[model samples]
Target: MKRTVDVSFPVGPVHPCWKEPARVKCETRGEYVLRAEVELGYMKKGIERIMKGRPWQEVMFLAERVCGICSVVHNMVFIETMEKISGIAPAERAAYLRVVANELDRIQSHLLANFSYCYTIEHETLGMYLLDLREKVMDLLEKLTGARVNKAYMVPGGVRFDIGEETRHAILGSIPRIREETKRYRGMFSGGPMIGLRSKGVGILSREDAGRCHAVGPTARASGIAVDCRQRHPTYMKLGFSPVVRDEGDNFARVMVRFDEAIQSLSLVQQCLERLPEGPVLAGGICRAGETVHRGEAPRGELSYFVKTDEYGRIAEISIQTPSIMNIEAAAHYMMTGAVSLADVTSIFISADPCIACTER
Candidate 1:
């Protein structure tokens, strides 16, 4: 007679599976996951408190520190909220450039996320390949922003600088190769035999459950929810945008959604560069006392910020709700549902692309 091994333990605060410090308590009967719970707050930085009483101009760098991975969206959302409160409009060229910077960040982020997923599934070769490809996107970002990560590029009314002729020519030359690499990776993720076998029908989050959990970004999109703030943003609308959605609501679906979005983002970058408008990038205006809200579709999902200004136009209150919060919470609950195996729990958790830095911020 064969014996069954019952297991129940925690997988973090220090674990090989996750990059950050988080605690995931997992209970299992034999090899099947019976329950799981995620404990956060190991990485909180009290950034909202720091933003209080600061000028809107100074908060841009603070917001960028919220998460190294989703820094661009955080800064953009903050700037947009401030612009709304102060009634300042960025120039058309600035808006398009903002989209370009954002999409480049999106491409790199999605690639890193997919690589993480592949690593969790023990696909080392694929992970290395993705990282190599991701380097190209990062190089482009470095050229545009002068910093590979956490670029303090956006100012109150517009970006801090403009792309020079040399950088512009380089971007134009690299688009086709980048697009080709993105398409190749997309094909590998969508139909690759190892990924399909390990991810297909695994960690299924049904459409109804997804709605109830308030999922966002590619997580919700993979579950067939079509909500992308980019499609609604005026600048992105002008550039022509659409959400990538899949109905499978499984790990494979989640990975495929990101793959498809990366391909789309490459096209968006091409559009922004080709149609690069000519004009000033900054609108330069004074801030007025007001309250406002703004949203941006980050690589992981919807990132939103609420801003309140004092009589002098200084920040009175600023609160942020990153996509990782809802996505991580909901995924913790989904981990125990259905027939998820104990071995696959980490992969499933990472599929949601939970950024603890952003979540606990």
Candidate 2:
């Protein structure tokens, strides 16, 4: 006779598998998970509250600190929203430069994300390879923006600086290697038998559930939802950007979608470099009293900012909706339920790419 018992398993506020501090409590019977719940609130920075009464200059830098991994999009969206309120439009050249810098940020972010997934699944060699490539992408960002993490490159009227000929040549030179290496690793991820056994058909988040939970970014796209915020952005429209999607809705699909998007992001960088326009990088403008909501696609998904400015152009109220908030809930409710293997529990949660830094903020 065999005996079966249900047990509570917690992976969590501190773990070797994920970089951030958050807990996942799984109810399991034998080797299969019955349900799982995520516990957060460990890393709330109260950044929005701190931003109140601060001028746009201070708020801009504060916004970039919301998430270290996807900081550029935060800076861009906040600045663009301020520009809108002030009736200022960035210079044409500055707009394209913004796109280039943003796409570079996206590439590094996606690579780091995939690297995290690989590491979680115990594929350390592949993870190391991806991390190394990410460093190269970070180097490119440093060359363009003068800072690696919080670039602070975007301004009200335009960008802080223009790219030099040497910088342009270096960016162009680096793309092929990154692209080729990514392609090879993507193939290994897709075709490797052990990887398939661990990833394929595991942690499935169906299209219906994905929509219901309002999943965003690669997590949503992997479930066959083509909901990339970039498609609606004016600059991306000019670049003819399209979202990459897959129907699997599994761990493998989520990771592969990121790989594909990283490759696509590299192509975007190249296009920006070749079609690099010539004009002033900055146009002067001042933040004025107004209210507006702005949305931009972060590496994880759609990030939204709602702002209300006072008469003095200082922040009166601000609210942020980070993609991780939605995705993490979806993972705990939908993706982590059913007969999930205990071994696969963490990988599935990670596939949703929950960023506590963004969520707790």
Please give the CA lDDT of all the candidate structures: 0.86, 0.90
Candidate 2, RMSD to the unseen true structure: 2.9
lDDT at 171 for candidate 2? 96
lDDT (Cα) of model 1: 0.86
Looking at model 1, the pairs that clash are none
After aligning candidate 2 to the native by TM-score, how far in Å is the CA of 11 from where it should be? Answer: 0.9
TM-scores, each model vs. reference: 0.96, 0.97
For residues 1-361, could you state the per-residue lDDT of candidate 1 as single tens digits?
Answer: 2333366567788878689898887767767777777877799889999999998767888999999987888889998888888889998889988998999999999999999999999988888889998999999999999998889888878998988979988987998898888788777777778788889989888888888888999999999999898888998888778899999988889988988898889889889988999998888898889998888898989989999998677899999999998888778887445455777888888898989999988
- Superposed model 2: Cα runs more than 4 Å off: 1-5
Candidate 2 structure quality by residue, lDDT tens digits, 1-361: 2334388888888888989999998888888888887778898889999999999989999999999999999999899888877789889889989989999999999898889889999999999999999999999999999998988999889999999989999999999999999999999899889989989888899999999989999999999999988999988999999999999999999999999999999999999899988878998777789999888999899999999998678999999999999899888889888745888888888888889999988
